[model samples]
Target: MGRPKQFDPDVAVERAMDVFWRKGYAATSPQDLVDAIGIGKGSLYNAFGSKHALFERALRRYRDDQGAVLVELLERPGPVRERLREVLELLVAMDLADSDRRGCMAVNAAAEVAADDPAAAELVRRMLDRTEGAFRALIERGQRAGEIAADRDAAALGSLLVNTVVGLRLMVRVAEGPERLERVIDAVVDSV
Candidate 1:
């Protein structure tokens, strides 16, 4: 029989996630995983099968942890526009505040791994779909309450909001300050 594991797999995955988030998949080495997870190479393989498998788990963990924040912000009780503004503002704040400037993990994964990795692409796509759906639902709520124009298409608006967020997240990687992001927020909120 195999030996019992010494470390918590969940904690290991979280650590791996941090490493992957800070460094894209191609740049992260096996030794990086070994050091971050505090496990030997063989044990790491035994626990997660391979680097790709471990990255998948880490991405899923990011989805559960970071992706949930966007959903929660959108679901907060308030005017739809205000809630959307808060979501955008919070994203800017969080992205800027991160010392590593990692930007959105899902977004980074989409840009880095989505082309060559189908599983990772699908995972990122599903997160985008869920986020767009949440925005669509919130927009519908606003339309029902007469806050948003009834003539506006919620689906299209939702897609635009998702696109805007995607751009904002990517932009934060190169953004010099909050000024440009604030303007983007103003323009998007006004358009909605």
Candidate 2:
């Protein structure tokens, strides 16, 4: 309809996501988005409605794109213990290799706006729910496969692991190296 959108929506959103990811919602200006995404002001407005809408789409994209790995890993048909270990190892690697130390866009959004904005809070809540659900399924699978203690509550354990990941992501934002993460991984896995 409108010139068929000159750029790829995915690529443009990815670029916009990087801008928002680097700078939080309040700080990321429309001009910044224009500069980063190479999209004109009118086109951006027409395509995305507003900055907040664009952010929501980008955040959803992030979870759907980057977070798919977690969902897939959790769903894998394997011993629960090994799957959990794999999840933690992947988490650790993500923390260590994060060049920008962006500390997870979802977590960052949660910290930045969960208390103030209803829309943002809802987004944060959904992200948390999805993450915890993945963990719950993994834990349940472990219990079913005789890998995890049967007495343990999968929902609670999953919530705990989600919290651990949030904490670990936050810690990596300030910590210089992986020493703290190694200790954390050991503690989390050993407990499970």
Candidate 3:
């Protein structure tokens, strides 16, 4: 009865992720998704429910992938400041590598839809929460080990770092230079 599914769902979602990453959710239509994902309208709906659902899935995937990388990077043996620098460095690298200049899918979504749509907003919120949590934990460990200032509140520092990170992603869209980003990273580490 139904046409056999040709595209791998994960691959399709990754493609959709790129499209949505480039164009915010409000600007992206179902036709855009169909074209980008190479799946028919009927199949797209049947497989992923709707554009909103697909976006949710894609954002989740992005979060999981980024989270895994951040965990590994933070886990590796290095000074906390170096770990922080490496994290920002990696982000700059990704931004520079992308020819299309897609800043960040999650950050873009957070900017565009986080205030209007509940589900979409929640996804973005969760992403920020996870990022803040990671930074907070790292800061806590750094303080305990005398790697950072013990007087600094890791919670506040974590929030600040999360904001800085998202700002870095947004900044990449308009400005890009390794030296510039490294300077910002230095300032962030100094503040911590």
On TM-score, the leading prediction is 1
lDDT of 2 by residue, 33-87 (tens): 9888888888889889999999998888878876787788888887776787778
Q: Per-residue alpha-carbon lDDT of model 1 for 1-192, expressed as tens digits?
A: 967559999999999999999998989999999999888999999999999999999999999897788888898889989999999999999999988889998999999999999999999999999999999999999999899999999999999999999999989988999999999999999999
lDDT of each prediction vs. the true structure? 0.93, 0.85, 0.86
Better of 1 and 3 by TM-score: 1
> For model 2, what is the C-alpha lDDT against the true structure?
0.85
Worst 10 residues of 1 by lDDT: 66-75
For lDDT, the strongest prediction is 1
TM-score of each: 0.96, 0.92, 0.92
How many collisions per candidate? 0, 0, 0
TM-score, structure 3 vs. true: 0.92
- Give per-model CA RMSD: 1.8, 2.4, 1.8
Worst 10 residues of 3 by lDDT: 174-183
CA deviation > 4 Å runs, candidate 2: 1-5
Error of 3 at 104 (Å): 1.4
